[model samples]
Target: MKQDIHAIEVHNLTVSYDGKPVLWDIDFNLDSGQIIGIIGPNGSGKTTSLKAIMGLLKPASGFVKIFGKSLDEVRDRVAYVPQRESVDWDFPASVLDVVLMGRSKSQNLFRRANKTDIGIALQSIEKVGLTEFKNRQISQLSGGQQQRVFIARALAQQADLYLMDEPFVGVDAATESAILELLREMKSNGKTVLIIHHDLQTVSDYFDYLVLLNTRLIAKGTPPEVLTRENLSNAYGGQLTLLSKIVDLIRQNEFPVREKGFDL
Candidate 1:
């Protein structure tokens, strides 16, 4: 397989919420067929970056290109698993029902799933070791199981590029191991996977490529190259206090006073 070209690219991307900047001039090109992790402190736009790439959130400026094309041009080739906490598991949907939703991308609007779609959904559930719970309601499963169901759904889509946000946030050790194994399998099958991860200890073990972000593009490269102490300190240090102060001001419809120009 050709590995010379980029699978995803972001150029000067910036995003904001209610006049509060979240991502700042982000730029990166990710190669295909690897487990890539994006990590940073909370409120560092980790989720926001993935959302921008998947077109779930619009960029205030700049652009995102999937396989050298706009999201609209390559939507079918991409699959996304958002942060589990962002989803309402209590919604009335069964395990199989949620997994089958992945097939919606392969069909036209208002269309029903055919037999083949059902087969694919079943296969995905089995791959994630959730076949026994396929018929169970989503809310009835544990946090790990719920995350696996979402992964199975993304798998059923059969997309070449997968973007996942914090799939390991609330899972048990066994579940985390299982998900990482599945990600490795996907990489072996020539798929590109990008995940938003938080744990600093497992960074080197789980991902071959790492993108460090703290509301901006801090560094991007192999874990060995980007996971240095200096980078980590810069990305995470003073973030909590800064975030709290900014949020407090935003709630009051105001921003911190600064000199002519200052970087947040």
Candidate 2:
């Protein structure tokens, strides 16, 4: 069969920082309309891979193609939500002001946001359940509300492929649920989403596909296959040996932590 043209394809991607290698020769293809999660221990190049894909960092030796086109050629078709902590929360901007930044690339530098842009931004904010808080300063909202604003920004971009970096890190349960629901809706609408996530326990529940990384691609498949004990060991290392064992047991029994009374 012919390869799918509408896929995110990374080929021989190697990235380094100050002569020190971070990501090494990674390759994978992800098609549209699936919620894919990238998981690994800290310093496993999860964020690095995302930065490279988003063109925030230059790869030493590789390329990423979205919808079978170079990033520059399809820049507008891609939306990225960087790590929440990466920005200054104190910036003086309202929630809607921040979300409208998503449309910046489409407008000339001197052009002001048009009515259409504002309309789209409002719609995105509503989608994330933040319509009432759109006029509020971003820093005034709770951590989860801030995260939702970022998600709304990405939605406003209206991209075909969404790349997020650890979106669930500091958010509350309600915000996490809201984000996941929006992601599922995006997938149902035929948009592909790749999230950099750290939680191993919730991996199986949140993603339809998985990418396990450790300075290199470890495994990419359905959660059942990629979250295996051996794969977790390879990705997270022997330090998580006991944790991996517990996860494996949980997988085998298909029981929730409360059901098993195991402290996670």
Candidate 3:
């Protein structure tokens, strides 16, 4: 893809279920080589927007472009990691087996994985710190391990852009930190990762760009620009207790603050 092209361009996107809108006329553009987060309260359509971008769900209106082209035009350059809970753990696949699936798109459907493919899969597993578990059944792995397996699968794809939904939802702190480190490494290598995330306290620390949504586009910018009192209230309906915590974080110098010419 061209360096000047945005990683993703979502224009006037809307999605609905049973005629009730889940996402309403949302719009945003993400630059390449950064970690971006989509954050919102429960039932706020965070995952819905992600699915729309990935073409997993049909939008009621509007469109999405990946790297200055339609999703079908650049699908090979994108990788998607769905929520762990949405997957079937008992599918009887080993870690290596699942990771190799990432390479399937590049090979003949009826062909078996070649030595090169296996090598790539093993390298991806090692990157996730799961080399020993490569042969273990996914169903036997812990929640964190299972999550890592999916990440390894995405890594094996070697895509330029990664779209993940709630990757940190059920993992331990160590796993979360490891995943963050890996994501940072990917960013340094010029990969753009857009994640659907919760955990407001870590939003500023985890992502370079932030998209705050609630059935519509609330805010989209750097963490300091989006996590302000007014934007949070607009997206989250002024939940005082949550807002107070964010305020306290700012006062304590925990959350990010704009350097100049802007106020929270």
lDDT of each: 0.89, 0.85, 0.89
Q: Global CA lDDT of candidate 1, please?
A: 0.89
Cα shift from native, residue 219, model 3 (Å): 0.4
lDDT per residue as tens, model 2, 1-264:
124685688897877665555676788888677899998888878999999998899987778888888989999989999988999989999999999998888436788999999999999999999999999999999888898899999999999889999899789888888889889988888888999998887999999999898776889999999988899878766654554465456556654433223211
- Candidate 2 runs further than 4 Å off: 1-3, 239-264
For model 1, residues 117-230, the per-residue Cα lDDT tens digits are 999999999999999999999999999999999999999999999999999988999999999999999999999999999999999999999999987777899999998888
Better of 1 and 3 by TM-score: 1
State the weakest 10-residue window (summed lDDT) of model 3.
Answer: 255-264
Selected candidate, larger lDDT, 1 vs 2 = 1
With a 3 Å backbone cut-off (N, CA, C), the pairs that clash in candidate 3 are: none
Residue 46 alpha-carbon offset, candidate 2, angstroms: 0.7
Report clash pairs, candidate 2: none
Pairwise lDDT winner, candidates 2 and 3:
3
For model 3, the stretches where C-alpha displacement exceeds 4 angstroms are 1-3, 238-264
User: For model 2, where is the 10-residue window of minimal lDDT?
Assistant: 255-264
Model 3 clashes, total count: 0
